[model samples]
Target: MARRSYKTELGCIACEDLSLLGAGKEGWLVDNPNILCAIDTHSVALANRSTILVLGWSDSDGSRLKIRPELSPIEAEYVSAIEWLVFDEIRVIVAGTSCGYMLIYSLRGDLIHKQMVYPGRVIKLRIHGTKKDLIQDTLSGELCVVTPGAIARFDGSDIQNMLLKWFEETHAHFWGLKPKRQGSEDFGNSHEKLPYQLWNVSKYGNCADAAITGIMPPPLIEVQSSQRYYCAVAIGDDAVISAFRLSEDKSRSLVGTILSKVVPATFSTISSLSKMIWRSEQTSPKKPDQKPQSFARAAPLTCLKDHPRKGEKLTLSPSGTLAAITDSLGRILLLDTKALVVVRLWKGYRDASCLFMEMLVNKDIASSSSKYYEPSKSDYCLCLAIHAPRKGIIEIWQMRTGPRLRTIPCAKGSKMLQPSHPFGASMSSSPYVPLEVFLLNGDSGQISVLNRTLDT
Candidate 1:
């Protein structure tokens, strides 16, 4: 007989109550509320509509850290997404609001910096970073802010430098020393605006969600240039999957285009010309003379075959070569990010959520020397974990035609989460910290972790 899979080797279960936030509570019309959550090594950020709370990973004292954003009294907005940002031994919470404002908060619940990213609602904020090799110190990272019709990218170095300056100034005040700039209280207003590259991705369809999958290599016949092009993949209702090539050349907005021809370029500078026609598109109060934002033109790339059902949620693999998308019809489509093609599909699993995970190749062996075990060659494999709510099971299946490995019975209101690794870290270091998945029980407010184990 074939050897049985080690489903029984799932190890070291733990739980923490989460009932106070009312995250799992359900009603007649609203079965699943739009609750946003992000996890780091030591803390968890949970947002239920407007209120946001941060709790210690395992604090017995039950202390809650609440972030209070400074908002205008005239307009109201709610939180849409939250993520933990780690750079240079500092950890902070980054939150996006429905009114297109990005806010950064210190762990002590003070707003560090705020910026208006877009005039429309912010859909998602994705942070992607990578290194050339394990030994090399050179690294690259970017923050992609996605909206319905456009996408913008902020360089990682830009954000890091801004945070460093703020922290240094704050420290100087603590020591009662003369600081070069204003104190932390005035820093927020006088903060410099971070320059970003914007792209109009509304060609294929309005983007429900999107990400910068990877940077494409230049073509053989291409002219030598300093600017690098990027590939952006988007998901929507009309078109299930779409992609675009983002160019560096600036594209004029409708208002900007009309005024450019009427006004002489020699008479007015680029910044002055843009501000003359740039109008406020948002309901939030703002000065009419605010600086105008610029965007680059997006060229259409290959699009996946149109599907009747719309995609609901998307998750990407660690390498970013593959993406798992769940749809309205209870099916999951796995796509090759580089090729822009669907490689695999699964049906009959409605209202499902999927996440990419890694499993050890050799499950029978045990490493007893220490807790920090260095993995050897051919040690791990990529897998997809699917949470099927109708069947009340969490299924782990091997990727690219591999067989199902485990079917775990989970609670009805549970959610699967992938822990965010520290920013600016090397991908080679991942082997030291084996990839794992977390489970949050919405009904009972309990948290649990699932780890691989040898036959006991």
Candidate 2:
């Protein structure tokens, strides 16, 4: 998909109350006012009416809305976090906590499956695109290509060898495993050869019985698969943003090793990643006749947003150009993905603890003849919104200029919304809203949405 670079208004159709806040990728418009808020991403689910208390959108047309889901029943309330996974059109997985149980529900409100994943209260729950056939079957079978057996069959030893090669090529300190050393010959030798053993469990079965028996035990085959497929890992207090891979081949392996982290700025939470752009830089040679030396930039720039409670998450734009980050103080930072430098920062009034941040790019903004404009770029025209905690105080800022663009006050007669504890914001390149702000409501489990109107 092409990168977006313009901003437009999104109209709001409905609002809903949620006990706790969460974000999804898909957009939604509900017909019921009691429903209050609706968001659609990989999956579509609604927060119970009583639990959700606030809703807000960045665009006047309501393209993006934030909803906070109510907490589970006290007996089932061990779920400390909730997350969504949109696998294709029909399969949306809502993974949340139910005390000791890690519940996985479908978008259709059916209990598909549940597992006892963790021992203590479930702090966070993240479900990335799965490699399981069942999960793939829901997403149009594309994910089936990622099965361990399939990866082993297609990539063979080349995948392992590539990772080994990458480790060697990127780092100068190979712990005496350099090609110049004789011992280095065995470095990737195991990867080059597949080590699998097949055994016939019923090899000695009675011949007469085997012929009479309608069913016979099949041979047991064990594929000694390499462990190179551990490409993605989730890190944080609750593993909010779990990383996964889309490819297994060596040439594309680095791309598959994306680090996905969660942004906790807004209730409409999302994950982002950073891509490593590798280029060779030549150094001056000692002598004119000597060849210039080249060096590899091993560390790619990383982008992460602040978490509601602690830590941060990282995300990559669809076009891989901009990296967004949110800080614990409800501050949003945008970075050049390739250069790994901060290009812009957006801060709201008061700290935006547990608020969400999104990017809305207006194509018209790029086409405009403004000296600060560039049409060919994506994610240039960005808009940010937050569900403010204080009454009559919603802050919105332009990322490029770092200027406060608008501030929307809370509705009249509404109680001031305040965060139970101070936290930070997160940023991303989704083009939905540059930032979705939120304020936690003490231990009451309520959140309030603030709309910021730019002061002309």
Strongest candidate by lDDT: 1
lDDT score of model 2?
A: 0.30
Q: Taking the tens digit of each residue's C-alpha lDDT, what string does model 2 give over 1-456?
A: 674322222323233233233322121222222222223321123343323222333343233223333345655453333444332222323333434333434332334334332223433332222122343332111100111111111121322333345345425445544444223223322223222111111111101100000111221352443322222222233222222221222331221222111112221232112112333355547432211111111111132333452224333332334444444455555545444456876566243322223333353553456775433324443444443444345455554455655555543222222121101111221222323333322223234434322211
Q: Provide the TM-score for each candidate, comma-separated.
A: 0.83, 0.34
Off by over 4 Å in 1: 1-32, 59-63, 72-75, 133-135, 179-185, 219-222, 251-292, 305-307, 364-373, 376-378, 427-431, 453-456
lDDT of each: 0.71, 0.30
Give me the overall lDDT of model 1: 0.71
RMSD (CA, angstroms), candidate 2: 25.2
Error of 1 at 31 (Å): 3.6
